[model samples]
Target chain A: MIQAISASDYLQPVHDGAALPPLEAALKNLCRERFRRIDRFIQLALLGSARCVAGRTLQPDCGIYLGSGLGPIGNNILTQQQLIRDAEIPKPVNFVNTLGSSAGFHVARNLGLRGQNFFISRRGASLQAVLGAAMADLTHGVVGQALVGVVEEVTLPLGEHRLRQHLPEDRTLAEGSHWFVLQPGTGDSRSLDLKRFAEFATLEDFLKSVWRTGDRLCCARSMETHAAKTMQRGFDAGALSGPTSAFHDSLEAAWLAAFAVSREPGTLFLVDGHPERGWSLFYLGA
Target chain B: MAGAYIRGVGLSCALGEDAESGVSAMQRRQVRPVVLRLDEFDEPLQMPYYRIPDRAELFDAGRLERLLPPVARAAVAQAGLTPEEIHRLPLFIGSSCFSIGLSESRYAAALAHQSETAIPMPLCGYQDIAAILQRALACRGDTYTYNTACTASANALLGALRMIELGWYRHALVVGAEWANRTTLAGFSGLQIVADALRPFDAARKGIVLGEGIGAVVLSAETDSANRLRVIGGASNCDTWSVTTANTNGKSVAAVLNQALEQTHLRPRQVRGIKAHGTATPAGDTAEALGIRQVFAGLPPLSVLKPYLGHTLGACGINELILFAGALQRSFLPATPGFETPDPALGVQPIITPEAAPDGHYLLNHFGFGGNNTVLVLEKTAP
Candidate 1:
């Protein structure tokens, strides 16, 4: 078992059919004051998150696991023209962004990670996949400290599709990027005991085992199935209420979980609730 | 590190439409990589690619309906696996562009206002490969589709290995299917990347060629009597210098190979004929040459499979591995069909004539445009 030394989250919302908000608007919302292109918004959120978590950790070998939704936003547009014009596939310049694990590469390279990086993209199971891969990489000595985040960049495809599909209003293209640093159990001076990293075959199991007695559950898209299951059990709003978009949404959970610290920290819990292929993940606060 | 086993395989390309048919021809050194005949976007290029037997065979119900929408049905069927079998294993589908081919055609059709005549689901639509699997196999277990340009399937295989290693699942179903589409042809045509049909590692190669079809295999931890090939090891790495182009120096490519070697706990000499992802493009051939040299240095003779299988983006990993193992077992490496002269830029040499099979394991490497490289080590197992 490992301990998350520190954690921080950043969220950027992409509305449907609207051009991107100003790079300034994207930057100003962040706890950090860094500026870059709107396209690099996910990377920026990750940078701030990694800094927040790593600042308290002492581990030297750190890696990153990124969960995301809609994958890389720009890649869609990059290949859009190719699709529109009926052109032969140009050299696939936009292919790089499609990599779910490589999202960490941006943060790692920016931070000179020069160590280990993995991008786990499991559509609805993004969070579960990332946390599992990150924790596994750490335990297996794949790296020392792991910086993880889930980011979602909404584009016309996500929102317009919801509209086209007539899904739900609040469910429209949600976005967030969450990151945390996990150190070896003894690496950091902080003490928080994690119960067990658990998985589920369905959302019902998650709610019964973890959220049966809880309220105000903070969830990302990865928590959808379980989120739905909990909602059915009178947990709260369904998938429409919580995080929208990529593994990036894990950031929103980190933010809410951090805020719960002053309340005796009964149990900082994370669970998928309802995953597409019957995959859900849970993490505990020691 | 963990191992996954390969069971039930599928292949389709310029060479043949099914595994049995294609492997039969490949075993005897009979393959014809053809330069497609189409418009400039379909503009006929002079590149050689594994012959696509006949597009009609792809539709011939006598043997075709056996395949499904986009190409999923065909692939799964060729594997001789039923929905029951697929539902039991995790599904990983790898492809560069799932169905850009049909999608492009439909886009043009819709553009021309030929709505009624348009293909209902332009390959990219729900009915393509992804939907087909979810529909046909009713596969609900950890289904993922990987799109990493050329190395799509290879990278997908990497995920299967990781999942298996983590003990998350005992069995995985990997699918790599490449079929002709207008976009694939256009992409290569636009960049002029297609060589006169891949003469990989050959001196006179101008570029690589494109092929299509499906490659499906079941990987399991328990290699019972059904196990055909054991996945000794697999690795994926990003060069990170250029998103669309390989870093050229091949540092990342070599690093992945070293990592795979370390995991499989096999030395360089343990591998025999290497299955080179020789797309046979100018930069591609060179990068691969340098990568091989970096990893093997004075290693075993390299055999090229693109000549028979062509390039099956998502399917290349499983597709090539299928043929490579069969060819090695048969002791016949297909000739460098169109190779007339060698390029100076290329680093290592490719086997010119079919050499007798040596006793040892083999290495297979595939590199995609987006800096993704995957290498698999396969050891011949006794029956």
Candidate 2:
């Protein structure tokens, strides 16, 4: 079993015609040194990861598994505009930061970690992807600790951002950086476990056996509607909802991080996957 | 834990469309890089690029759709998996340019037609490649897309290998793809590292020549009678020295190399040969060479593959792996085509001629941007 020792959830809703609130001051306070040539995506990664690891001494070999839906969107937009629209080559820093792993690099450097660093993406379910990868490494004894983070940046000009994502015109937007520190073995912290079932019936049976009085359930937004509805009906402890007023690509991270930070009394089961493919239940126990 | 076997392989690069033909062309030392001139900028950029021989426009928006599926299909077909196994097969994709070409084309067209409301990135997300492959192959299993620059695909393979070792799945399809896009080309050019030729480990080496390729491998827990190559294990670590390059000191590189060897329970002398990262840049080769020397007292036969297929960045990890594995199956190690003079400062020289690839262990090195370094250990048993 893996344990979730700490978590940081930073979700900021962006008004239609407003600019993103500045993160410089918070980042300066969290980071060890001033980092140059970093874009907003990297800043968000540093912010969330540092905040999660704050007031704690991490193992030097703690691995970093960073996930994102639209990775480094701000830097990518600038680079694409420079190359395609302006007919100019991108600057070196901009080009280098265009990579998703660049953010992981900064996070590793900031925290004095030199362990395994990975940047994995699965669009809407990036949290599951990175968390699964990190848990695997922990289970295999590859690293003693894992720092997993999912960051999504919101660029200016809400209209263009919405168009880029193919969302509705009036759909509210938000930026978020959700982080969790996971470790193997049992401890006083909340225990995290992942269970896979080939069929929905099996998953439901497993959840039924472990359901507590105040335990909550959350069906992934990407889960099939009928299956989600069925799971929702089975659990009476209320469903964990994401920020309804705004959106980011990986809403699952928001839901999971909120629950992790809530200091709640009962277990939270987050179920995902299609009925045909398989079912995955991420259990976070109190 | 048992390692996963390389059951099937497919590749499309500058040499040829199939793995066998690409390896054959490489063994014959066929070095070809077409001159690519981009006149969009004020200073028209010209560089030699090793593109796949598809006869399509380099920047065609639909080129990836046309090029990627066949390569994946070829691997899955070679694996000869059952319909059920194929349906449940997980996908691990690695790439630096995922749907960026399509995004570029759309944004450019929008700019040309309606500049007033044009958006820079019309398509935003890294799931397009996985979605395309899933649709083409009719598989809806889990997907993990990695974007760690050059080490992307190598890390993807490592992830799949560990999961397979843990008995998570019977089989996994790992793909490394990079298609031609203005962002990669123009971005590398702007870094001022685009070289005329890839002369890895040579004293006169300047920088890297960019290339693009699509390579896929089907890894299974059980090996068939014909399977000879098995991905034993690997290690990856970050180099806090610099994000753009590994530390010239080679401590970080050496650390990862030692970590991989220690994890696999192998000593320096047991390694049969080494596939150097060999980007040909001054600092890249220095770091790799110094790292190898730090790990091994007597250097093993080294092979640098970028001469035949230009540095395929993120894809080079798997692309080169397929080519090297194919050569091992044929009982010959590939030669470095561009190594004319060795650098004394680095104390390394790649084999100028093909050598016998004995049945033993080998290490594949992959270093990328963001200070990522990965080393994969492969073993070949007698068929």
Candidate 3:
């Protein structure tokens, strides 16, 4: 079992015509030193990770598993513009920050960690991907402590952003950085477990045994409609719904992190998979 | 530790289109890099590039569609997996340039005609490669796409190995792909690191020659009778010293090397040969050399592969691995073609001629931007 000791969620809805709110003050207060040659994505990552740590001493070997759907989009956009639109080579700092791992590098340096650092992506399901990878490492004893995070940056000019993502014109947008510090063993903190079942019947049976009065259930967006409906009907507790007014590439992270930071009374059972590919249930005990 | 067997392999790079041909071309010491000139910039940019031998346009959007599938199919075919097994096979993909070339083409076209509605990034996400593979192979299993610079694929392989060791799955497909893109080319040129030739560990080494490759390997928990290579354990760590390069002091490099060696339960003398990252940049070679020296008293036969295939960046991890494993299977180690003069400051040298590759363990070093360092261990036995 893995324990979720701390969580930090910085999610703000971005108005269609307004500029992104400044992060300089928040970052200045949170960061150890002024970091130059950094972009917005790196800033968000550092802010979330530092907030999650909250001055608590972390193990030197804590692994960092950072997940994203559209990684470092702001810096990438600027870099691409520099190369194609302006007909000039990208600046060194902009080019180096284009890689997704650059954010993880800053987080590691800030926390004084020298363990496994990975930047993984799976589009809409990036949270599940990174969470699974971190849990696997924790289970296999690769790292006793894992710092897992999922960040999605909203680029300016809402029209362009929406066009890039192929979303509807009026779809509301938001930027988010959700982080969690996970470790092995159960304690007073919330316990997280991942279970896999090859058949729907097996999954239903397992959920039936673990179901409680106030436990909530959330079906991943990728889950088949009929399967999701079936699971929703089986669980008496209310279904957990994601943010309806705002959008990000990895909405699952928002749902999970919201639940983690909430005062929910029971476990949140998150179901994800396909009938042909088997089922995965991420159990977060309250 | 019980490691995963390397069941199948496929590669496409400057050396050749397929794995066997690539190893054969390397054994014959073929080092070729075409001069690439980009005139679209304010100042005309020219550099040496090692591209795949395909006759298509370098920036053709359809290049990835045509190239990635065949390489993946070749690996799956060689594995001889059943229909059911292939359907549930997990995918672990690593790449630095994932569909950015496609994005650039779309944006540039938009700018040419529809400048009013043009967007800088029309397609922004890292799932293009994975989605393409899934559609081509008809697999819907879990996918993990890594973007950790040059060490991307090595870390992907480590993820697969650990999951398989934990009995999570019977088989997994790991792919490392780097395709040509203006962003990568111009970006490296802007860093002032693209050199005329890759001279790793040589005194006159200036910088790296960027290249592109697409390589895939199928790993299984069980080994067949013909399997001779197994991916043992590996380790990855962050330097925290510099994001653009590893600490030139080599302490962080030495730490990761020691961590990998300790995890694999092998001493310095036990490793048969070493495949250095060998980007040929002064600081990169210095860090790798000093780290290797700190770990091993008597240096093993070192091989630098970037000379033959060019620096494939993120894809070099698996591209070089397949080449090295193929040489081991053939009972010989590859030679470093660009090592004419060794640097005394580094106190290391690569083998100038091919040597016997005995059945033993070997380490492959991979370092990338963002302070990422990874070392993979491979064991060879008589087939």
Candidate 4:
């Protein structure tokens, strides 16, 4: 059952810097409008992922396989700068935050949900691992629910014109977090199911593939237009929804649909296609 | 987790450039923890380490952009490819200290008031290392760097194996490197963990003399063939213990190793050999040996690599694995270097000299800070 329900997100234009604490209120208001801020935006999206549960119980078993192409790279640089400024010793919290578990620690701290927290750091296989982890946990009954996400923030220097000039052409090169909460179910639980998922050696094969069929589909957090169009079967109205200056906008799309579903259970589809690895598919349903 | 395969391997260290030389040194039982004489740090501690010594002399400018750059470069280089190749070509890189040499240079300058306002740096810019690897290999598959002290490289290996079994990527490269840095001196000085000399599992073992080395491996699913070290499965778990000290009770380490064995669906008795994390410090060695005895009470013969090369920190996992693979290839197990007598403190007989054991399920174990204790089960390929 791999289908997108409805998607919603908060005012992401606000940076994680000085402007964050104030928006915490605006974030709370969105939960009614279909948004929730558990603590950090990282957890907020993860909390949104809890929407995958199609039942009445408030919670489900959660196993998270969080990935990042660059991770909190900007924050990592900032923390590194702080440590570098002093030669004698490093600040304790700064050192702890620099570890790979930085984001995983935030999600666990904010939600107090302890299932399996893995930070898969490979570039393309990131989503593959996240989706793959959920599937494995699903088989073993590891948890009642699972939240998988990709969260990343950048440092000012990394965003500076000097650095952008240094990057390659293929990379999306942005900052943001996208997450989904996948609740386990058997049978045709997905509003739409992922029929075929394979990695193509060449770009031509990826371009010729199909994603949508006989319905209006919106792709979030990707540049999968060529493929999505093929899936629409020429019915049209299949559009990509986000170039939200965030790496994980697809996560927002998943949550936004959950909020929209309060009116009626709707169907939206989300796909994340990294340049190297193929694509990750999730079956979501009401 | 099911079994994973190791298709290719790479290594860079003091003993030799490739696995063959490193293993030959081990078989001969000749180990020399290199002396650290870098004039940059404030502390003038006479430290002995297992380092290439002059890594600056080793790395030229354009090596990163080459194809199949000798085995050393292949560690990080091979992971760059397309969806078809990328599936089987994931990447995991671990370094105990990537540029401790640079860290030492900066620290040394700052100490001697030579650096002025020049800020000493570790890796100077983070992108330099990965960028070179990325530029050279061009395989945009899955790549990650793990720096969990001594367990760093093993964690990378564990991650690569887990992702593959989960069907994330079909293949992977786990690479580890260490640096000759001022921090190594300060770190060991601060803790007094370094021993008078390099001795592992020896009755008179004093402390660990920090060392530097680097290693890399290309692991893939095309195994059960000749040229593959079958990684059946592994488990990575936290001890939830103090950062500096391992749990004296050895409960978590025991649990972690057992979990890895369980993941491989292998009984404890099926494990034919072990490559222990014998760091040689009184607490560290006793702790690990006890953890080992807990799992394999009437255990198979155990071997430690620390005596061969000073602990390479994050690079230790790959370093140990290379030696283990080499020993298996040569049909001989290297003596646990400097291990003369089994410590009565912990009732265990560390393999003191080279010996042969049936090649079957070999367990590679590693432990690190933040309570990371990981173990892997490797089944030697049938010739």
User: Candidate 4 chain B: minimum summed lDDT over ten consecutive residues — where?
Assistant: B59-68
Supply DockQ values for each candidate: 0.23, 0.88, 0.88, 0.13
Candidate 4 lDDT tens digits, B189-289 = 55666676866767888887776666777776555446546777776654434544467677766776777777678888888788888777776777777
lDDT of 2 by residue, B1-383 (tens): 57899988889999999998999999898999999999999999999999999989999999999898899989999999888888888999999989999999999999999999888988888899999999899988999999999999999999999999988888999999998999999999999999998899999999999999999999999988988999999899999898988999898999999999988999999999999999999999999999999999999999999999998888888999999999999999999988899789999999999999999999999999998999999999998
Model 2 chain B weakest lDDT span, ten residues long: B1-10
Provide the TM-score, chain A, model 2.
0.97
Between prediction 2 and prediction 4, the one with superior TM-score is: 2
TM-score of chain B of each: 0.85, 0.99, 0.99, 0.87
CAPRI grade, predicted model 2: high
Residue-pair clashes per prediction, in order, are 57, 0, 0, 32
Name the better of 1 and 3 by lDDT: 3
Per-residue lDDT of A165-264 in model 1, one digit per residue for the tens? 2457656344555666666776533332222222443344545566533334444444455444554565542232233342233344544434323233
TM-score of each: 0.78, 0.99, 0.99, 0.72
Candidate number 3, chain A TM-score: 0.97
lDDT of 1: 0.58
Q: Which residue runs of candidate 3 sit more than 4 Å off their true CA positions? A: A239-242
